[model samples]
Target: MIFPPDLVIFDCDGVLVDSEPLTNVVIRDNLAQHGLDLSIDRIVDLFVGGTIMGVQESALEMGADLPEDWVDNIYSEIFEVLADRVEAVPGIIGVLDALDAAGVAYAVGSNGPHRKMEITLSRTGLLERLQGRIFSREDVANPKPAPDVYLKAAREAGVAPSRCVVIEDSVSGARAGKAAGMVCFGFVAETDPARLEPICDSLFADMTALPKLMGLPQ
Candidate 1:
């Protein structure tokens, strides 16, 4: 974060809100119901860094002929659960405030669909800060690990990819940021720090530390 960022891009789920654990738990349980029986740790390692399509493809590889309504079903269940469990990531408001005080622009870039973002970010009280500013996988041809979403986000923000600083919670997102030429900082509070060590320019588990990395006064 020593570099002054022209734009700051946040990946919504784990980076901006504490939804990953809840989401992952649901995923694990749902897969178990599908007769997959994978542990939560295994689920995180296998799916944390990929798109829903990738997840579905992995399911297919696992011998699951997922019903066409499978993804929608999971989404419905996740939203219902999240309504009661969702919360912003600890210390993120301070980071957002610091960025605002420094006059830095930031936006959310996620692999989630619009409705998911609407439900989660809204419930977490982040919608007003980012409503129209959010970008999703539905906006691009390819999701994370492909650089499509990150590149489009940077382009729309009118900043060079090199001048943007991306905050990511997964290896796929870190790779996408790097692929888009942005420096990515990995948030490893809930995920194994080692997973993103190779791609993230820096790794941090606390949200309050981010503004300092962005060269903002702490």
Candidate 2:
């Protein structure tokens, strides 16, 4: 019962790397300095799988008195903290090894910028597997929830949209995968099922469940 997809596209932050909590912490801390306090849950709901510019826009919409270079400031601070803390999600290495053994082609499609993606992948040893396969939001005119990123990823992988499977951890990423006409499996590691269920084709509690969901022999 092998899945028919030619490629498996994964989201980076929460799916491949355990960086979402760190990202939220940086966001919360940065915003708090400007008197705009955001709860962790709120940050997760609004910013996960979204572009940094998008997060900055959200702050601007909230009437925060941000400097013209505030987004850069945020990126610098976040990356500085992330340099010492980035790690791969538990079980992801095994899951990727399984995919490799099965001769499955894969790529990363992330809402993060190229620099952040590079840092995370390089630091966590995922870069060797994903170096040329990573697609950033900067590569597309639109990011998650708009289908452009996933579409471009499939294209880059030489896979058809309908024959691709997307592994995502955020609601926006799942929506983007679906919009790209791919089967979207939501990773529910740091997310609640109820919140992810509506947008995903299926929800996996962790990467251990992924091979089964992908219809591989177990």
Candidate 3:
């Protein structure tokens, strides 16, 4: 049996909370007014596991005139929508309870900035539970698809990279965790199993499988 990790790192969106579709909806509605009409699938393909700055850069490259405060505006709209609809990922609290019972430390490490993390985590009633344990891409020079953020999360959690296990919902996040030298578990709650097969050590949708996969008592 595999040993449990010293630290369990969770990606915030899609994994910790069902906020992707909600956030993307806000993006779609607002961007349509900007004349950058695009499908929700296209938005997810481009922005999942990407930082707000990266999103801005892409718009610039595509010749869209994004205002200096456009990303902030998007975040404001997302948070407004999230207040009424966001909820924690199914079974996530139970998994966290199991991890707590197993005596394993855990933290959130996300490609999103701290403000977005704050807004979503709070709206889902997870902020108090995860208050001081959050880590964001805004804290590092390199975000997802780079080892920096994950490595920093492990360090902050007081664990070695190899002793950390990352739960990710996006391809970039899985790559980031693996590059940090940690084992990665891909959550297919929103992603395709086939696309995740090569990168994830284990692919699962239900959060209840996580404790068992990590060798924690179920």
Candidate 4:
């Protein structure tokens, strides 16, 4: 926790790309078709920061009775919608610009799989900006709620985890950032501040405020 971290690692779904609601809509609809109806809030509560595999496991435990091809099917559907609908989180591009201007390295670290990120990030025009700097859970042995992905991102950035600042938007993601020994800033636009406050080093609802919060020049 110092001013001007060496690296900034952002979670993808809600932090970088505004894809959570779009992704959740697909997940909710797909689950309802399988006889496991869940509200979007419930979906967020249970699956927002977890991997699709984690969703499958949890859904089965809750009696989802998903088909053998459920994971692939849902991913295909989610990717389709995201490819058409995903947008960069408001002011995120400006934040990236600020980081670039300050010469601060940044990357994406998410519980999502690489294919999912490729779809969302590419759709939102972020993939090129973050080329070769993205770390997905698929790249590691474990996902969020564990520090693997964030740690991997830090390692690849050639920065110590302690000197990295992680921007996350979910409880699991914030926990992962903290577990990785980074300064965690919970983005509260789509998540409850109460849920993140206890876990994060700080919280912000606006991407425009992030640069200042991280001690970056405006």
The candidate that wins on lDDT is 4
* Superposed Cα deviation of residue 185, candidate 3 (Å): 0.4
Candidate 2: which pairs clash? Answer: none
Count clashing residue pairs in model 3: 0
Q: Per-prediction TM-score, please?
A: 0.96, 0.96, 0.94, 0.98
User: What's the ranking of the predictions by TM-score, best on top?
Assistant: 4, 2, 1, 3
Off by over 4 Å in 4: none
Please report, as a residue range, the 10-residue window in candidate 4 with the lowest summed lDDT.
116-125
Q: Which stretch of 10 consecutive residues in model 1 shows the poorest summed lDDT?
A: 48-57
**Model 3 alpha-carbon miss at residue 11, Å:** 0.4
lDDT of candidates 1 onward, in order: 0.87, 0.87, 0.86, 0.92
Query: Residue 169 in candidate 4 has what lDDT?
Result: 95
Which pairs of residues have clashing backbones in candidate 1? Answer: 1-213
Off by over 4 Å in 3: none
Candidate 1, 1-218: lDDT as tens digits: 34679789999989887888888898888877776878888888888867666777798789765788888888888888888889999999998899899888899899988888888888889899886789999999998888888888889989888889999989889999999989999998887889889999999998988988888866
**Model 3, position 180: C-alpha lDDT score:** 92
True-structure lDDT of candidate 2:
0.87
Task: Count clashes in each candidate, considering only residues at least 3 apart in sequence or on different chains.
Answer: 1, 0, 0, 0
Off by over 4 Å in 1: none
Flag the better candidate by lDDT, 3 or 4.
4
Pick by TM-score: which candidate is best? 4
**Cα RMSD to native, each candidate?**
1.3, 1.3, 1.5, 0.8
